[model samples]
Target: MTAPLAPPGLHTTSLDLGGRTALVTGAAGGIGRACALRLAGAGAKVRAVDRDAEGLAALADRARGLAGTVEPHVLDLTDLDAAELAAAGTDVLVNNAGLQLVRPVEEFPPDVFHTVLTVMVEAPFRLIRGALPHMYGQGWGRIVNVSSVHGLRASAFKSAYVTAKHGLEGLSKTVALEGAPHGVTSNCVAPAYVRTPLVEQQLTDQARAHGIPEERVLSEVLLTDSAVKRLIEPEEVAEAVAYLCAPQASFMTGTSLVLDGGWTAH
Candidate 1:
């Protein structure tokens, strides 16, 4: 878990998501949970989707404290019908579900690569296709994809992850262009290393892969590449996701909001 970086006594008021129905994929974990909670906190009726039944239940329980209702749905995003069902009647959709694999290109498993692409790219595309009618009918909608800094740059041993993220950004932009005329907007949030269970697992895998200490992997490998010298907090990403869903954000679309602590500044 990364520590909060926002300065003390400087809080931005959250927008009201009231009366809006939102579907958040990968809502059981990290950035997904933060986005879900933030949307719900602002009064959106949230449907939290995850493959983990128990985790989804726990997330739903947690949302109750935020004075928002979260309905848990356990379904594989690879299933198009399931994705459509989950997206029905949703005013906002957050495509946050994804997988990351670190392996040399020559050793990358074809099946693993295909599956990652299915989830990170194909699934989100299908969800957008499924959700578009409703959004267009209402003349309002928001689609926020959780991309990565890796999408903009290359990294060792991450061919499949990088490919999927880059493809996702293209899809986001294309959708934004198509939906702009319909009052629907598509955008992406690209964050640097976020301290989540998935990232912790990556740290472990990377440490073992490079024969380096875990602390060294974090400090030397992760933070070393970022100007902020720290992992981004999931909440920060969530806040940005919520902002993009607001009425004030209607003019913003088809752009990658890079929150890499200036990792790409160079």
Candidate 2:
């Protein structure tokens, strides 16, 4: 059965970000791509940052005719100084770049754990550090961290990912407190498993780690706790990111807007 649409004006987002600029890391694909497109649609010039040159090019093409524009920027987040530099002068920062490696704690590579934290946690700190100056100067800015259910909960074989996300949650709140006096707001959009390349790769790794067929991983693992019984779409998460940046969310800060399909309720 088709669901009824909301009355026209009653449900429109009506967010306008004209003349603003937004920086979305990992914009080459998945949630980052969706966010870059969403912010651009709201008339904000979007800096699409990712190391994937080809993917960035594709995103630039897709953003053509948008209300604002997509500017591709190729940079590895591991370069902390460069990441910070890239964020300067931006009014909006969406720290959506991330990675995951599923392995038992005993077998997880130390190097990989370090890399994950560097990219997901440390880089965001630098980016926010860089953005705050401009934001504080203007007394207005929006910082949206694309965290995960891992930020609030835990699963075996995801130690590093869980740790990094938990840390990100803390960092976001600190920024909120400091930036509040400057008209800057910081928040996190924590979603359950969203349909994306990262999650696709996790299915294979999870199957290997759990000694199960890949086909069984989704039902037996990924969505086992989600009452909704499906993965969220990237665009759906993007809409939540957009809402936080809209004027209506001016008073909301330092907390997470969870899109977890009731996973935490149980």
| Candidate achieving the largest lDDT | 2
What range of 10 consecutive residues in model 2 has the weakest lDDT sum?
1-10
State the RMSD for candidate 1: 1.9
- Candidate 2 residue 132 Cα shift, in angstroms, is 0.3
> Quick one: best TM-score, which candidate?
2
Q: How do the residues 1-266 of candidate 1 rate in per-residue lDDT, one tens digit apiece?
A: 33446554534455887788999999999999988888888898998988999999888888887756899988898886778767878899999998888788898899999999999999898888888999999999999999999889878888899999999999999999999999999999999989788887888767876788776788777777787877777888898898898778889999998999988988
The Cα error of candidate 1 at residue 102, in Å, is 0.9
| Model 2 CA deviation exceeding 4 Å by range | 1-12
What are the clashing pairs of model 1? Answer: none
Say what the RMSD of model 2 is. Answer: 3.3
Candidate 2: tens digits of C-alpha lDDT, residues 74-109: 999999999999999999999999999999999999
| Per-prediction tally of clashes | 0, 0
